[model samples]
Target: MPALFPLLRGRVLCSGALGGRKPDARVYARALAQLGARAAHTLFVDDLFVNVRGARAAGLEADTVRDARGLRRVLKRYGLA
Candidate 1:
């Protein structure tokens, strides 16, 4: 992520660091708690469909992205680009 989006450096969360992996709702919950973010206001983007589904199940807005270009498009949709 740092290589693709330098501005996100040190601002990204790692599931492993949160003591869980993608597709595990706990990871997303922990992340939201740490960020003090509301599930409805957050967008979770991942390359895998399962992970995206997991986020949605956790009450977060989610999308599946293939690469940096796709990520850019998704972020743009959310007005974050």
Candidate 2:
């Protein structure tokens, strides 16, 4: 992410690596703050389904993607690209 998305740098939670569990809404809230957005208006793009699901479960729209193009499509779908 740092290499490909230097501009989007922010807090990163590696919760999936420790356990396939979702972070709570509060965690998402703090994370979203780093991006200057609220969870309700945020879109999380991740390659792993578990992470995507976790983000969704935490009250943010999310998508499972494999590459930058896929990510771009997601952003475009949300009018963010």
Candidate 3:
């Protein structure tokens, strides 16, 4: 993943690493804490609506994208592409 998106290197989080799963606000909190990031400044992207909603409920800007193209589109919309 890092080879394709260098900016993601050392910045990916999984359920195990965060000790929680999707749709859980605690998971988002843990991830933000680990990254030293503010929820308002973060853009959380997931393919599942439940996860995206969870992010939003946790006070983050969230989006859902099912493919790389969709992901790119969302990133572009946010000026991160």
Candidate 4:
């Protein structure tokens, strides 16, 4: 993953949590806030409702999708098409 983000110019690791952990929204939200982005200005997309709910709890707009078709529908509904 570090190789994928070699620039590492605007990245920060706030918590000691692993990326593979479930309900990582809290960690992500904190990192975003630390980087100067309000939760309301962020969008979180996940395949699991648990993660989505966690993100929403952190004040971000969250969505869950079961598959690619569902993701397309969600993007279209939000005028992201």
Candidate 5:
């Protein structure tokens, strides 16, 4: 796993499970912070409100999307499209 850390940078890190038993956003947020990123500068997108709320609680801006169209809309709103 240590060998894969470097390769994971700049990638979208997500929990493998669809719902239960997944690592929460707080964990990833803290890891990113330790990697020298400010939570406020990070944007977390998830389909679930619980996950979105979790990310927000971790100090990151978060959005909940219902589908790919919603995701595109968010990206456009952020000028990331």
Candidate 6:
């Protein structure tokens, strides 16, 4: 994963890499705040409903995706792609 950082750079967060034992949107929200982003304004994308639910619970907009194509559509909906 360390070697892949360059390709995956820019505002990406991973709980396992960050030592989180479980998915927690509050932790993600705090990280976003530290990075100068508002939780309400950020979009959290996850393939798992549990993760998505956690993100929404923490005040972030959330989306579920099964693939990159699905993700593109979601982004387009938000004018992000």
Per-candidate local distance difference test: 0.90, 0.69, 0.89, 0.67, 0.67, 0.75
The CA root-mean-square deviation of candidate 4, after full C-alpha superposition on the true structure, stands at 5.9
lDDT of 5: 0.67
Per-residue lDDT over 1-81 for candidate 3, one digit per residue giving the tens place of the 0 to 100 score: 234467887677896778878988999999999999999999999999999999999999999999988988998898887
Tens-digit lDDT track for model 2 on 1-81?
Answer: 335466555545454443434545555655666557777877777788877777888889999899978877887798866
lDDT for position 37 in model 1: 86
Determine which window of 10 residues in candidate 3 has minimal summed lDDT.
1-10
Ranking by lDDT: 1, 3, 6, 2, 5, 4
For every model in order, what is the number of clashing pairs?
0, 0, 0, 0, 0, 0
Q: Which pairs clash in the backbone of model 6?
A: none
Query: What TM-score, computed on C-alpha atoms, does each candidate reach?
Result: 0.83, 0.63, 0.91, 0.61, 0.66, 0.76
Candidates' RMSD to native: 2.5, 4.1, 1.8, 5.9, 7.0, 4.4
Alpha carbon lDDT at 5, candidate 4? 53
Query: What is the TM-score (0 to 1) of candidate 6?
Result: 0.76
lDDT of 4 at 53: 86
Better of 1 and 5 by lDDT: 1
Best by the TM-score measure:
3
Q: Between which residue pairs do clashes occur in model 3?
A: none
Error of 1 at 46 (Å): 0.8
Q: Candidate 4 residues 1-81, lDDT tens each?
A: 234256446653425543334466657656676677787876667788987888787787879988878866776777664
Give Cα distance to truth, residue 72, candidate 2, Å.
Answer: 1.6
Candidate 2 matches the true fold with a TM-score of 0.63
Error of 1 at 51 (Å): 0.2
Lowest lDDT sum, 10 consecutive residues, model 6, at 1-10
Candidate 5 runs further than 4 Å off? 1-9, 16-25
Candidate 2 stretches greater than 4 Å from native: 1-26, 33-36
Q: Model 4 misses residue 77 by how many Å?
A: 2.3
Maximum-lDDT candidate: 1
How would you encode candidate 1's per-residue C-alpha lDDT over 1-81 as one tens digit per residue? 355478655557999999999999999999999888899998998889999999999999999999988988998899887
**TM-score of model 5 (CA atoms):** 0.66
